[model samples]
Target: NNFSKSQSNFMDTMLVFSSGTDIRNLRQISAEIESKKGALVENQYRLRKSEVELRRKMRDFNNMKDDAESDPFDVEIMEIEIQEAINSRNGARTYIEAALKTILCMKQQYDAILKNKGIEDVTEIDFENEEEEFHIKKSTQQAFEDIVASGRISVGNNRYLLQIGIMPNLVHDYWIKFLGSPNSYEKKKFDEAREALYQQLKGSAIKEANTRGLDELFYENSCVRIEHRK
Candidate 1:
């Protein structure tokens, strides 16, 4: 009977040790997951920054291409910057993918530990759509119409103004008309003039729209339309 109790005690002690070890491993893995998520967020930021820079550089290059005063060396530098930004953005995407894989493996291990312990496994999820509250009052609708009428586009945390890729008739009718002019010399002048006005609106119309209360959802959709126009 004494030998039996001893054996049972030994088994119970081993079980406790195993449980403790598993818990410690879970804590370690959780820490690693948190670290990896932070890295993923950083990479996302880098990707956006790189994309915005590349887009700006390309626009600048296009606008300056026909300018008599624009230097070839400067254009070459812009091309190099754009290429470097592309490489950096691609590297950020690769890092994010690798980080996701590592985190996924760690999560699987964590889940396995939960199953072994007979503990309920809980998973947390976040949705981008849930990030912002959508408010669509009548005034907000009015503001959205105001923005649409103005042909203005804006985005970012504080709603900084950005240029629409495709110019509306309200904004660039003259450019379209000039491009289609019958006189070859007029078309040539229009081409060489570098029509810098077509690039983007100078200021955010969002603030003006905000007076009537801009519909956040509509604003987001409008921004999407502006982004995909070209």
Candidate 2:
């Protein structure tokens, strides 16, 4: 959205510059966008690494499941592997979903530029429409792992109360929250809740939780700190 807004500003600058308006502001904005472009690229690269790791785990699980008939313990171990693979897969999926937004945002930015160039209308661009897949059995187990891993996943009691999985309640909540919101607000809420989740994902929880509301770092205690008065 910011990119699109900036593109609009670029159009305005075209007229303003011709009428003796300075391009200094436009230059600054362009530089800022360029810096953001670099950061987004870096993030995309990191996400690709995560994607590769997840794909490898998925392959490992498939191979193990294929070989599960060899031993009694093999099925059990393979199931565990499958569950881990699901977790990694979901994590990577979450990252990809977030990154796709950037791509969409960039597309809009480009579209906005075109609009200013006298384009009448724009087509709806689908930057990401493909849904991620998970083994149904594994996903059924994901709720439990989420509860086990995070100690949260709320299940609906209004149903049969068939006792679906361990911490069934939290699992439902996890799925609900995951599907319900794609905005940064939900991401922040998830981060806050994750602070109290299980230990395995503490690193991820903290990393996400640490993202600030603004680019500026707020320090409570520092050599030089700025205090805002109410």
lDDT of each: 0.51, 0.43
Clashing pairs for predicted structure model 2, backbone only: 152-170, 153-169, 153-170, 153-171, 154-169, 154-170, 154-171, 154-173, 155-169
Per residue, candidate 2 scores C-alpha lDDT tens digits across 36-125 of 666667756765776676677667667766774667576568677657656765555554555455445544554555566565433212
Model 1, range 22-127, lDDT digits (tens) per residue?
A: 4555655677689889988998999899889889988998877878899999989988888988898777777777777766766777788789988774322111
After superposition, the stretches of candidate 1 with alpha carbons farther than 4 Å from their true spots are: 1-20, 121-230
TM-score of 1: 0.44
TM-score of 2: 0.26
lDDT score at residue 149, model 1, on the 0-100 scale? 53
Alpha-carbon TM-score of each model against the true structure: 0.44, 0.26
Task: Give me the displacement of residue 91 in model 2, in angstroms.
Answer: 8.4
